[model samples]
Target: MSDIVGELARVAGAFDQPTLTLLYRGHAKVVIAMLRSAFTRDNRTISAARLHAQVDTYLDQLRIDGFTDLPSGSGRDLCLRWMRGQWLVRSVADDGAEVYTLTSHAQDALNLVTNLTRERASLSEHRIATIVNAVRRFNTEVNPDRGARVDILNSEIARLTRERDRLLQGADLTRPSADYMLEGYGELLQLVAALPSDFARVQEAFTALRTQILGSFRAEDRHAGEVIDDYLRRTDSLMTATAEGRAFEGAFTLLRDDELLLQLREDLSALLSHPMAEDILNDVDRRDLRGTVGLIRRGIDAVLAQRNRVTATLREYIQTHNTVRDRELDNTLRQLDAELARWMTSAGPRTTVALPLLPARLDVHHLRERFHNPDDDAGPPPLRDVTTQRPDGLTLADLLAQGGPSLDQLRAAVHEALASDEPLASLGRLFDALDAPLRRPVEIFGLLHLTTNMDDFVRDKEHTEVYRTLRPDGTRRDLAVPVITPGPQSPDSPVTFAEEPRGRAPRLEPA
Candidate 1:
């Protein structure tokens, strides 16, 4: 073999099988080199063949059989597969080789070691803090036995001094010069008394006693603290228990004080499930609270109904009353119209009817003469000098002495007189004073004209004629005047006959 192979084989032979396997598996190259160096020291050179044989034997003994150049299906390959499935220490063989080194089991062991280290560190910190707090608490208390011993020493010293003074006083008179021992004792006593007062020593006694009492109290306080802590612990336990569905102490007390309402509700629910109780509640007529309530409701309804009725009656009465008043007012208005019509007829232009109802408030002679004869050119038809004539001397011829007017002049006069405000009674007298042949006065007092049948006319009254003009074939024609007598006409009495051939005739009695 070559020197390099001899050197590497010798280096690999001295390594442990695990180190050799790790080298072969390509792990911790520096550690593998260091392991190889132990075997490869200058003076310790083993021959390459011997080194290979030893390494091979070690590998077999350790069952580290995978470090080889094996093809598929070789025993070495099988060993490698087994090693791959397990966690075993690994190293190199007698010759250099390469693969990944760590086994699963070795990795797990390292991780476990790391975790244990971390836990040990954490536990160290906790224990250190616990010891610190305990020491701090311990330093604050006095030593009770030491303080009591100091107090007892101080009291014994004071008692011995008093006894010495008393003994010295009693024996001094017997041997004055022989009292040196007493003097010396007194001197020592003085010197000892002169020593600084151990106030701390005295105070230590009270402090110790106080500390004892306080310690007792503190121990009690610890019990109280334990009690409080226990109470808190119990409270937490109760809360946890309740959360986990366990009953806690005093749990029912809460229900009794405040949560009793839940019980009441449950009871009420149970009551509703009972048929008799449910029926009783359902049968209660809440609508009928009291008779007074019903009565008041009924009374209010009645009052409203009465008010509506009264209002309706008042409205009807008012309407009816208004209708009656309106009808009466209408009747009064009709009567007024009729009376007005009568008064107008009496006051308007009058024809020469015989009985004139004059406005008796005026005289006749002072009336204006408005007529003029068109043919004769005479002054207004001569006014009747009847002002001087005796009322008995006026005959028809005397009345006719007044000059008359022509038809046209009379028409003018009638129209003028009608147009004026002259009363109807005056117009009648003026017509009587006229001497026109056709225009003559006729009696008209108490005339009763029948517009219906003659059977309805009243008797024993004078009558007059009324004329009407007509148009026949577009020519002006005079119609026969209607003769109205005051009495009912006999069916055969003077049946007058006049046709259109006779011209319009007056259906009047001869004057």
Candidate 2:
């Protein structure tokens, strides 16, 4: 169970150092936006000069935004800082200009940041229905041997189909409450946020494979040819046989189908235009829903493309090694021929000249027997570390104190009340922190309930909380708190308000 929990944790962990810094470090968002913009449309590689210009333009805008202390060359410095953190990879371009690409780490970091900043979303029956149906379709196409899918389909098909018919007929189609609609929107957005992370995770796997291949080539004890052969074999199995790989490949295949794209676009248009949805769907939500399927498909394509890029690298390595070996074999043969000619000239013709066969390069498919890194605790498609970021702030306490309290008045009251030398403090202290009108019967009860829940509050028979009130005549009267224990087994009756005649205040009693 511990191992399972650790595995799940490892899968979710994708935020790297650059991602963490970008969130809190000033101007980091501008720098990231610049990078994203540079690559967003068509370009994957950005030249130093062009990127610098883009960053400088961004910084200039920052200055116009009234940020005066923005340092000079900070844009370039920021880019380099990302490089140092392994967020960006720099290499010389064909024209000798330095070019940069977002490393898998950088992509993962960006995805992580986006997910982190996303608004809290709720899952709902409608969203769950749509998502589950899509997943079921995927499972049928990708993993047909699974047992429960068909059963689920049989169970939901009639109900869902009838609902769709009613929606199309515009007959008795009622709009869901705002809360329900908002929840559905949030659930959809959460899935959208998660899709990019999945892409980044796959990209990271491709990177890990590339790293392994490079490591194998550089290792002193292993033959490079054998290492590569084994690497290729393992890679194929990883892509085809592993669960993560299968999910990605299934998604890739599904998305790559032109028919599916067309159908998805149509379905989204139809769903959004439906009379039932019209009330709930706003322009932004509609646009997002319309584009979400396409965006997800694009992300999956990018991830698969990363795998192809890594495989291409492996092919290049193999081709280079083969070419080099062929050259060396030719040289060895020519030297042998020279020796044979010399022997013939000195001691007459010999019956035969012996030749040694060159050591063979292993076949690509059968290279599974090569050395794997000893440190790896091999699992499905064996991978290495997930991303981790060094948190900001000077100490653990500082790090923990990351956000503001929910209510300022309540916060101050709780703090000072907790610090008081008195074992028992008046609940009115909290109510006094706010307007008298704000401290209604419900509010006073809420404050009393909060004190009982806090560990700092000492509760005993002697500490039966009492409230003091000063009258217009300057005499004091006491009021008794009905409940003292934390969330009660039987909550008190609801307070009812009654209309009062002319000048008297409204009376309240439990109903």
Candidate 3:
């Protein structure tokens, strides 16, 4: 009982808070009044203009009844509020205006409120057949090894055939009277009422399972493998041992049983068309009778969609848990790839190449256009002068291998410059104090970045040492660069690095 109440509370939190209050007070009639006239009997869609007209009529009637302080009469805002309560769905029309449709949840809620509580139910052939079918389904599905499933099916076929033959022989079989039809519909109505409640219960089960998984995840003592094993165990239990799960399986099987559905459809269609049936069934009862098979199929689809939602959530969590491990695995594979590539390159004539060289440079856009329109540029493209090329054609790896100084060497040289007694030591001063190798733009930028990090050195921004720079096309400019100098270190704090071990991963216990 407590579990059911708890689940109810969870479901209540998911819907509009005002929904239950409004429904309890019969205010659903207000919105439903608009909905009935907003569209035709067969049509589910309502245009904004049509809906406004309905609301206008409703408000005018309210005023005639001497109602006071009513809000502005636009169905648009009212419809939007109902949408928040999951009563309606909206889409944009061709003219960029809104169109509304009644949702399945809203239909179920309205049906439950309007029909199920209106009358008392009693047993009939329909009720008896439903109970027999449900029990048989459970027996075969849950205990298939008991070995009576084939016999049950065979008996059903024989019984149906015997009835057909009796009718063919013109035997005066007792047809259901008016009272019998009403009783049968009462049973059918109860079944349809329970279907939505059944779907809600299944949804609750899925929600509870997700909560359990997430709680286990957030636990400080969680073992990842145990969490996963528990998840699989819960999934199996939900599928095999639960009534809701079995009901879903039954509905799914029914959806694929075209012969059975066709037979049921013909039977119901014939039953509802009887002149006696018309005397008992009102518009509401007729709607229920006409939509019975379709509603069951839709219920089954809802359950399956929930099942898929839970499965997708599990897949997503598994992906999230493995993200770091997958990243590490990728890094290891990339290292292996680099090793293989380097081995291949060293085995050939070129030992200096860092990455594989292309036969020609790639221009992605030009290539795409050329492939699509091969003859568009019939003439050959132009070339540039060879004098534009630089002399330093060696790869960075080749330069490193040939014993040139690295970033650490440059930083150490700058550190020595910062230890001096000058107020501002320019790059020229550093170059004079320590040997600055063939000054390239790369080396200059590297030293400038290194100067930012020295323990007691900072940039003197008010001054700059200008350098004459030459561009690739032979253009020149005077570029201003920062000069570094030693500054007083702060008395209070010093930077320190901490070392901690990566903890052991969680493991699963043996079953």
Query: Per-residue lDDT for 260-341 in model 3, tens only?
Result: 8788788889878877877877887778668767866765665677677777887678557764675688799999999988
Q: How well does candidate 2 match the true structure in TM-score terms?
A: 0.47
How would you encode candidate 2's per-residue C-alpha lDDT over 464-507 as one tens digit per residue? 34444333234544555532332221223332222222222222
Over 4 Å off in model 3, which ranges?
Answer: 1-109, 116-170, 219-221, 240-243, 253-255, 278-287, 322-511
Top candidate by lDDT? 3
The models' CA-based lDDT, in order, is: 0.38, 0.61, 0.62
Q: What lDDT is obtained when candidate 3 is compared to the true structure?
A: 0.62
Worst 10 residues of 1 by lDDT: 443-452
Clashing residue pairs in candidate 2 are 230-367
Error of 3 at 201 (Å): 4.0
lDDT tens per residue, model 1, 194-298 = 111121122123323333433443244343345345434533443233321132123323434434645545654553454343223332111211122233234
The CA lDDT at 388 in model 2 is 55
Could you give the candidate ranking by TM-score, starting with the highest?
2, 3, 1
Error of 1 at 32 (Å): 17
lDDT for residue 38 in candidate 1, whole number 0-100:
25
Which window of 10 residues has the lowest lDDT sum in candidate 3? 502-511
